[model samples]
Target chain A: MSDVTAGALESYLTGRLAADVSVSDLHEHVEGWSRDTVSFTARWNEEGEQRERRLVVRAESDAQIEGDSAAEGNDVETEFRTMAAAEDTSVPVPETYWYEGDRSVLGGRFFVVGHLPGDAPVVWDREQRQDLYRAWDEREANEGDGKADGRAKGGSENDGGSLPSQFVDAAAGIHTLDAEDVSALADCPPDAVVERELDRWVGRYRASTVRPEPAVEECIRWFRSNPPEIPETTLVHGDFRIGNILVNEGELTGVLDWELARIGDPLYDLGYASTYYFAGKLIEPIERPELACSLLDREWFYDEYERRSGRVVDRERVRYWRAFSAFVMMTIGLAGVHRFRTGETDDVRAAWFQYIVPGLIEDMLAIVREDRL
Target chain B: MPYLEPAAVLRRFSRFALEEIRPAIDGEERFVRGQVGSMASTLRFLAGELDASERAVTTQENALHEALDGVEHTLDDHDAAATAVREALADARDTLDGTDDEAGSRIRGTRERETTLLEACDDVLARVEANLDDETARAVRRPLYDFLDARLDAQLRTLGRRNESGDGSP
Candidate 1:
């Protein structure tokens, strides 16, 4: 069944811990679509010591397993191994404990991680947007208040408790990681980055689309014919955004959702992050929509990322990936719609995705046309 | 006929769900509340769409035909790529013509017609880009781009401002 029960979890933990255990305060996070995330306190006794630890379980839901989200190379084990590898990096991922593969335990494979503090901000929420905007304002004030090094130099400590610098830091941390170190990630050759990504998303689009989207098809054609030059390949946290970053009192605590993480062009993440389709454009009241991820100034972000990663920011290549990012978003939307239409998922949000299709198509068309000149 | 219209009923129920049922549920029931809110908005949008769907369908059909006209004009008489495009278009038009007598198949027919026209447009653009010069290719793509814009405008108009929050993350 879709619902993971406390009893099932307790039984599994008891067996794994080799001691009697009780699971309580189980709370399911309501936001995400792909995984079923449950946070709870598990009490057990080991070596005559009663212990209590708060933990989070990330499991593949039926929708994730059977729906279009079953994209190749993305699975619970991959996510588990990816996080385990990143534990040695600067990225603030949740500390992973163990991976469970036996389906009889929780109906599917899941992994446990230490429950980290912080709420994942919903970027579309007006209050969250205001919070990020205030962070930007505070950082500006600090920068002007004789903290030039803070803004100019760029570091987590000097970022004035705002998320922009930390956001860049997290992205840089991921991009700079040795791809070979992450043994679970698929090998994406430097030469085939653009070709592979285009083929993957375009193939998914063709398979899952409910109708013929000429705009999307045009984008696919354009992208296929005009593949961007890959500068270098690195580990890309494919869904890098403010929404995926956990924030507590204006500080980024953990980067959540690594299912989309992979080995690809690092610039792809930058392009995905900078899409207005995913940022300030969602908030009707935000007057400044140029902030990358609705947090960092676009140019500032590029400059900061370049400075941190020691990689030159190729604005032209970024532009190509930005346009391709629209296609990625459109393909994902179509996938959700396809899953819904095919009766694979009953989630109303999946059906609701059709609402965003036109806007994405408009973005793709506008970008290619304006940028072509 | 009933005194209350179906759209009006849907809107009223949507309001009831958002304002009445949602508030009555405990605040801790965030998932349930979110679902209720989504259902309300979806029903409200559906109510509006019920009235506008026919018009939207007609507009889309017109746009498809216009795009197909531009596609046919751009194709060459003897080129293999152009032949492929013509074959796709002819097959779609034939299917549409065959289904013209069935009133129930109107929407499906329009959608199938749209699929064929759009695929042909893509094929033509690909062939033109490969065969023709940059300047000529741009000239050929201009009208098709216009049709795409019009079709998208009709879609946006139909969808309105609902879910303006943009795309969701996985």
Candidate 2:
């Protein structure tokens, strides 16, 4: 919003859409913490008729959480290519129209994509949405009470209910995308995937360290000593979580936030998906439990993943990567704290980063101990 | 000099002579050595204090659990007390928004104190789980330990931020 005027965005859209396209009602979505996300309605004169369209603009911000620079440079371009490649494939990504990596376009890189029809329930704010529990219960009942194959029939459960099945199905679709078809990222060698990713992140960590942590040093040593053996190479939706995915009426309409997409071990996605409980939520079907359940319950999603991908997932390897994912998340949280403390960034989200890092560390330690012992 | 205790006089003389007198007369190498020695000693003192406090807390927590073992139904009460303490800590944390420098410092102190308390709770719970024959005692301890573990984690995150801030430095 700093220098990204509506006129610039409209012009950019005009170039992508029809010549008579006119954009109206540009507003920001405040719920998203990652990108400078803005949802706007576009009205255009097309074929002797006025057509209305909804579009979302995802632009990079000066202030960002850690591990986002991976999305910078040609990374966004790679994402665009990946999305385009997955168009005919099973993955349900939004159809990207225009992407501008140049800084001059809107003071930072951004992409415009087709706005899919869906509504993401206010999952973050659990209080107002007491109806979610009822919705979840109804879906479970319908699935059990001779309704249909709820998993196959995507998003038919109406009444604006919870979309847990949609979420799982969309994830399975992504996991099953033909790895051989993604030729654009063929240069990414499978063997060096771990090393490349670790080096890139470690370099970022080193640069961002205002004060060194002995624990980080120890963690690095441990990571190097006990690198998990890669079983299979697949495209990792680097930030595969409930928040990044969008669902409508019990069906996944679009898989958003491909900024963190990369070619790596598929378990990274599985581990990340399972760790959503740490963000404070119950398992998929049971939207509201009387008490919090173990994140391990979400392993059914992994079983579903294995079923779809036809790969026997090594549970021990998945456990190892889960700990690694937690460590990566902790590093990002630490980076946010570093930036905020150094006055490099002035954002309130930075403070929450401090609140979450320690919990992540403890969780990571717990995972490590559980795996080893 | 007359008013000063012997220990205070020796400490004052050592600090003054090492920091001021030795630096004035000695070359850069000697000054560097003196500064390094001072820092090392300061670190050693802090490390010693932390170690002693940790040991004392562990001992007291162990004794408390040992005493509670004989008392029937006391473990449940103790477990509930620990939960209440954690809830109080959480409430305190929720209110802290780092409004001012003093508030921020207080929040940090509270976080560290809560960490210590939660760790103690975890140690006690772990011991109870090991010693108690009753399944209820073990069941009650599980949630308490889990909550305390999560709480300790949250506090450690806050501590990580504080450490990154270089708060006490001039």
Candidate 3:
């Protein structure tokens, strides 16, 4: 188990499926930071019939930072189970097939889910590609690319267009899920939602600082004095944004990361989604300067969200949470810079966070000022 | 108005953290077992410092509010005093233009009061400047710093103008 030996995965998958199986095209997927993700093709002969399938392996790592994964009461098992449970729901989660929580199998908790084929919606390196933009435009224009049957018939390139509508529909579906059904998730008491979020992030900010920031002190006081009231309790995808999701041909094949998924004030998710508008990748109309538009114009997505959910969003509350989210981003980004300065991770991505933190602060202040006016 | 001693408040908080919290939880489970074991202790130290800094900001905000309140209270007095000074200066100019007499004496009295009001405004401005530190004023720091700087500049210009007009005492 020092490495992902082929024998180990084959043995594990065979045990879970109760069939003799062989894994081929064994390769690792290089997208995650909290967990080691691997993908492979599986083949088996059953009753003299040939069968083949593509699968993804998700394994937890001990070295990950706390916020990169869920902080409390949730872990890899919970994520796997949540994805498995959502298979029948309108949410477009990958279909989870096997979960192995005992550490003996792969040195840590791990699971396997069906691997749907598609280009991820947010590609960090090749973000300048026009074809990708065109594909996104086409998908957003269509509700979401069609079902897998349509995908198979039309082929991978022509297959997905219904993704945007599907993603929005999936989010609405998740919001509508009964709290009783997801009782394993601890709910924030109605009154303490904002306080809990503030405390959680304040702890993160406090824990992650390597250098003294006088401005951050003022930000904390201002944030606490003006806590926004929660409009309603709903499930929050703590890291919901364009980059965290996967899409193919404008269809959302799967919701990718669940490490930070939780039950909390729904506006947190809305605010989190708004973070994408400033991600330096998702600037809309395809040609406008990313910085030209005010953050208010980005409210189109939220407006659509409100219209779809039939809930009159508290604009002030959303604005406050959005500012809170930006502050959280600054804290986390600064933390990444600290880690790099302290020799935690050698990856260059850690340093990139520093360049983004100040811009995020400026954006947060601008958002707060605009809302106040 | 000077803000209450924020630096002193911060010092007290830091002392309490070092004396009380540090020794008590030095070897707790989470503290010892986490990746950054002793780093947690360092965070506690930083938190102590942050508490002090926060107290300072609160103190500064309170002082600014108080100063603005004082300005409001003296608004009528300031206007009346300034008007009387201006009237005396005008009367002195008229006396100088015509014959020196009891009217000129009356002008001098008004001019003296005007100088006193101007002196009071200058003293208040000086205290405000002394109370403010551009770097450490965290709450409304930028605007307050600008306001104080601009006020000082404006006062200096007014003093220069009065001197040129021969209305300012030697």
Clash count of each predicted structure: 0, 4, 9
User: Which scores greater on TM-score, model 1 or model 3?
Assistant: 1
**True C-alpha contacts between chains kept, each model in order:** 0.35, 0.08, 0.00
User: Model 3: which docking level applies?
Assistant: incorrect
* Candidate 2 pairs with clashing backbones: A155-A250, A155-A251, A358-B157, A359-B153
TM-score of each: 0.86, 0.62, 0.61
| Cα-based lDDT at residue A72, candidate 2 | 25
Residue-by-residue lDDT tens digits, candidate 1, A82-172: 9888888888999999998887778778999999899877667768777777777776777678553355336454343357778888888
Model 1 chain B — which ten-residue stretch has the worst lDDT? B161-170
lDDT of 3 at A272: 62
Q: Give lDDT: candidate 1, residue B98.
A: 47
Which clashing pairs does model 3 show?
Answer: A143-A162, A144-A161, A144-A162, A144-A163, A145-A160, A145-A161, A145-A162, A145-A163, A160-A249
Q: Which model scores highest in DockQ?
A: 1
What lDDT tens digits, residue by residue, belong to model 3 across residues A18-112?
Answer: 78989888666544556777778888777788889998888876544223433422577877766665565657778888887677777777888
What lDDT would each prediction earn against the true structure? Answer: 0.75, 0.53, 0.53
Mind giving the per-residue lDDT tens digits that candidate 2 earns over B1-170?
A: 47755444445555665566655654534424544444433333333334344344334333333333322245445554445434433443333223124665455553353344444444444444345444445444444434434343333332322232111111
